[model samples]
Target: MTKQYSLKHIRNFSIIAHIDHGKSTIADRLLELTKTVAERDMQEQLLDDMDLERERGITIKAHPVTMAYEAKDGQTYQINFIDTPGHVDFSYEVSRSLSACEGALLVVDAAQGVQAQTLANVHLAIDRDLEIVPVLNKIDLPAADPESVRQQIEEVVGIDASGAIACSAKTGVGIADILERIVTNMPPPKEPEDDLLRALIFDSHYDNYQGVMVYVRVMSGEVRKGSLIKMMATNKNYEVQEVGIFTPSEKPTDSLKPGEVGYLIANIKNTQDIKIGDTVTSQKNPAPLPLPGFKHISPVVFAGIYPVDSSDFEALRDALAKLQLNDSALHIEQESSMALGFGYRCGFLGLLHLEIVFERLQREFDLDIISTAPSVVYKCLINDGQVVDIDSPAHYPDPSTIESIEEPWVVCHVMIPSEFLGTIMNLCMDKRGSLEKTDTLSMDRLLLTYKLPLNEIITDFNDKLKSMTRGYGSFDYEFDNYRESDIIKLEIKVNDEPVDAFSCLVHRSKAEAKGRSICAKLKEVIPRQLFKIPIQAAIGGKIIGRETINALSKNVTAKCYGGDISRKRKLWEKQKKGKKRMKEIGKVSIPQNAFMEVLKTD
Candidate 1:
């Protein structure tokens, strides 16, 4: 016999926290307490099923599961748990995931207290007006102090601290109490009249055999197999061939109703037909108002994406387009470069998002990619009274034609041990970061805020901060506004010819050192050919400094074999042919690391 519960008795919620803060572990413990999976079949962080995600110990995507738990009163209730990604890279995805939930479980590390990302995610939950159930996780660790963490959450987030739960998601202690709190505190979904069919698409993915699979939160609709549906956003209609609820691993039902979260399979061959924020309604009794949707996320970071093998251009385009179907945050367009061949101009939310996209392309699609340095969008006003938006160095307006240039800035928060405060402050100063304020989080810990140029954050700032702090510092930033600043245009010349592919704009004070370091790195990696190469950096037309790469030369008349004169002559002839091939290398123009080394300047 199997257990069954009505829609009114179900509670759909998501677990959110900072990275490595035990959100997934707590989810696993919840599953165990409810006997959702057999005890012998348990695994660590079970929701992170992807091999990459498991290795990294982070959840890259949102996953939903259903379980039935019996309370002390001898009544069974269905719980639909959603595990969301904890990094800022997936913040937009987290927002979309929250739309399918009535509340969220905010997990905080008892030993570490609240981190920058922890506060950021908690604020996001509050903005959505989702009921928050705070949990102090990792109570079994040696440094665990649940009382202090509870106080911090109350003071920082301005929430009631009386009902906070303390539990070791690892040892299963206090797990039952956490479950009881969920049933008592979290509100049930408000039932709709069911007079019209309406549902909000929160997430979606493509399947090779099943076409587009959309995950929706039913608001006022009842949908079943063999129903005709219309997408209000796209004005396209389709026949729903199958419908079922997500069982953490798979869909195992034939229909879904109001207050339920489930997946619907429509015979819409193209994945683009089903967008993340689109609305699905019955073709006969469509609702008057469209489902509440979020404004599309505009990318703040831009970069050039190229395949290591130029022949894979089409494959790369197809792969990115497919990824964009599932990820609305990824934006791509056709881009061409004489040096890089045909590629793409892709936009991302941040640096981590950029890295993840490149990694997925190489791992999932089996394609090799060469990405240029990531850059932020710059707002410029031309001398002709025209406003221009520049995302790439190629699109930067000529200095002579610009009236003023404004660069994006961010409000940055950094938390570190007090002993390393001086080192971090020096780093911030060197990167043009202006300190806003500093406060003590504990006796030996400090929280510092800075207003820094976005250009600095796009460089190696994150890695350098971690390295200087011995991996103990945590930081996050949000776009504040733009400020007017003095800027300089850096141009690189090869063999006394200006190379558009090696040009960039940087702050005036840092231009000289940046130029020298870039040229030095280029001289080391670019291979010599039949002719020597001259690398130079310039402000306008006059060269500042230069480095030369000597051409290769060798002796061809050294050896002969016993009566094998023809073979030796053939070998020498091949060497002459190699010299001709070397000519192509000399004309290659750009260094192998030219694009990457320039972007490394902090």
Candidate 2:
């Protein structure tokens, strides 16, 4: 059994940084230095347990582990740290992890220095009142300039980096100093146990053999096996079957005490029965109120997910239920499409978040699925002062509501080389974005702030920015507010029949061009039928763009070679009547591939 460390000797912290900033590498070195895992079991990115994370070279979830490190004072201390994702989409994961800690190690790349996401994460830490320790990583690279980066962090991030540790996480240089600083400079959890039980649920996952396992940090209580617990927000009670801490792997423990981060298992058959950010308390001696500062993060982007095969719908729903247990930000509801049949309309934080969930549904659940074009939540104000928020095009309210529609907007921060400033600004302007502020961080680097409609950024804007700046640009965004905009639904019609799956919301200024582009794409993919198929893009009752697929024909007059011209005319009339009748009642057979054609549209 592992020895138990007192609350005063335990330090809980998290590692936060920008994408590709060596955050995971620093985590690897820390695991090695603390001997958390045996030498034979130690590997690169040990905490990244998912195969997708290894393949993408990114951290998707926040991983927590307990490490026992003997300090120079000849005493062993329990260091509980969470390795968080650096991507902008997973900022919610970082925030939830930070709430369980008293401090965070703010790692900035020595070469790339501070980027957009670095500042965003630092603000999250500051909001939680966490002590931020600046650690300059990747100093072994040839372009490394630790001194300049320290100054950059101070000037740009406005953090005191005078005591920043300059280390190469790749070469294990100065790693020992980092650990020492964490133990000395960072403070331990100060929440005292007053015979009241309150454990904050940080994260969770589903297990088939056991049940729903919840990841939590004890703030001021102790929970052990056989302890009856109650979720304050949910008011659900369960008998604790087990309580343990993750030593890189689950290690069964006698009990979880205050200031320790651990997991608990009970009779939670359904993932929805437990709520994240809920306070867990002793059922017999429950707390009077839940913990403060629990904010429910809402999804900004919405899309429809349908199984490729109709039979896997139930499996898809079950897979999403399990995923929801792990991810609280993902919202799903039952929805159906005229072209795609039954599916789920899921809301995600961003495009990347939508994509990651889509990928996981396929990989983890072993299910084949297709998702529709993503849309942003639009608030519709009725003429009578009633408000309705719509995410799917099918759910859009009647246009004659006699009021304005409001679209969600975001404040986007972009950090890039000064040479690419003009191109970036022009690109943003093309996407209906307005420049708010431009600050020059250094002679080469510039930071530009832009306010843009959330719908504009959901497309290929990130790809365009990377291509234009040659991958040197860093981007981050936060929700601002809803503003009134002239937004309309762009519906696609095949043979005068509206395909609900192909419908989406578009801005008035770009509706005609967008409608034209989608019609052109559909014309290229949809197979030609015996009758003429007129593909049209429309807004309400007006058609904006059209494409025609000519009917395939075999000349009926060809069989009357050298016959009378009257007979040939008679045969042509018959063929024309048949074609007209076919066009009147023919059903447009839209294949599954036709549904994806709109999804891939730029």
Candidate 3:
């Protein structure tokens, strides 16, 4: 706002909940009640800007907006709230959003009660010392049970929910109460001891005309136009070209003071110069110490991304660089393969994260790409006492020289109706998961805890869980300690040539079957050649499965019908010799279709 609000007048908070549990709807109601957006301009999912997020009905990125709400106490309050993603893979986004806020609104569905993600988000908010206000949504539904939900919230989440506000965001019932509570109940920003200009870069994006737009939360001091500031992480100094705040959209401001969230345009030429979580300070009088940054985001799943045409390699590289500007969780580096040629090995938080990134590359950047089989990060201890972390099977070390391999695992919590417990148990057991604990949240809703390898769930584990439960299952997981596991690398070879893109690591018990299935899929896709092609799956020197693609017949004996039998035999023998020479000297070419089909094999 143009008016400089004192520290006590400012309230910074965030909205946290499970996916598809009325987070966006509540956000719409807040915006409407506060008059942040006009009644005519108001629409659903006001913060979800990306089309992909709208189509998928989920928030992929955290969105922040500044509002000026006039409360019942006859005081104008400046409220900054971040709407965070609810999916487990985007928990990092939630963390970033929470760091910028002093409190949070924990929304829960009355019918669904306490789900897995609800508990996980509660823990995240608690760890950050955020003041949480539990709100019950969808009370207008016929099955709404607010009393039982409140009890579950208190007993299951260990939080006092006696004053939980019961409201339906869809119908605008009790929306005023939610806003009033945010202003009166949430704590104000802490007092800044000094005014040396220390602002944290919570999020950032690139603009073609303005370069990089750095989002900031001013902890102390003021940042105005033409003020020289230094990025604490990079130690680079730049003059602030402009400063502003987001009114659900960018609005230029004369200055941003303490306890305010806004953006800065510093004439930055490129996106790579700025890093999320870096502290901003005035170059003339910098802060005594920098703020604590966020923890490193380690990707759980990895896959290879290559352009369909070789000439588009440079475009692919540029596209990835641009993509990394907004998505800090995405990891990409140059990795070349003999079969797939030049590409990058990208890492993601989970399977959904991987899918979204791939889809964005195709849709946003208009680039055609081939994604290889996804794999998990493995820690291999060598015989010489060195540990190597590898995400791609091409990086796997020699089997004899490795002392042990440790695979990452997660503790998963699934909330479903009691009727689906048996089938859920069978599915987890099939994925090499072990049951750890089980509890009954309500009369019919049950929570099951299982320890499963991260590799198991990166595939179709979530899909199967939803299918078995008839779409009533809600899943969430957190990283556990790494442990040694019996895993082996399965490599695929066509015509005796190893293909790095098709290789994957599998457990020893399932290696043969995995290899066999891969071989079968490759056999159906690869085109026939003049010489017979052998598709083999192997571990080291031992071949476990093989499929042969028959060669095309030449029909060279068509004119030799009346000739001597010896002449026909001679022609056939000559042809056989030619085929052997071609098979020995010729190289096999793998098409893009073959790569897609084989890499997607389950």
Local accuracy of candidate 1 as per-residue lDDT tens digits, 1-602: 23445766778788878788888888888988898888888899888877777777778767778788787767787787867787876776777778778888888899998788877777778888888999998999999988888877887667886688888888888789988887778877777865588888877777778887888888876888888989998889888988877656566575677777778898767766666667899998888878675556688899889987889999999999888866767889999887778899999989888888888899999998888777788889898898888888788777889898888999898888899999999999998999999977767778899999988888788898899999889987877998887776788777667776667778888888877877887787777766667889998776776888877877665756477688778887888788667655546556545665555543
lDDT of each: 0.81, 0.88, 0.88
Where does candidate 1 stray beyond 4 Å?
1-8, 39-41, 252-254, 383-386, 484-488, 527-533, 542-545, 548-602
Candidate 1 residue 133 C-alpha distance from true site, Å: 1.6
**Model 2: worst 10 consecutive residues (lDDT sum):** 269-278
TM-score of every prediction relative to native: 0.87, 0.94, 0.92
Give a tens-digit lDDT track for model 2, residues 347-422. Answer: 9988888988999999889999999888999999988998988898887888897399999999999999999988
Query: Top model by TM-score, which number?
Result: 2
Q: Deviation in angstroms for 466 in model 1? A: 0.8
Quantify how close model 2 is to the true structure by its C-alpha RMSD in Å: 2.2
Which pairs, if any, clash in model 3? none
Q: What tens-digit string does per-residue lDDT give for candidate 3 at 1-602?
A: 48889999999998878877788889998888889999888888999989998888888877789999999999999999877778888777677678788999989998778888888878888998988999999999999999999998997888899999999999999789988999888899899998889998877888889988998899999999999999988889999999998889899999999999999999887666777778899999999788875555678889889998988899999998888877767889998988778999999988889999899989988998988878999999999999999888878999999999999999999888999999999999989999999988888888899999999888888899999999999899988979899989998899998887788899988899999998999889888899999999999899999999999879999988695799999999999999999999988888789887876677
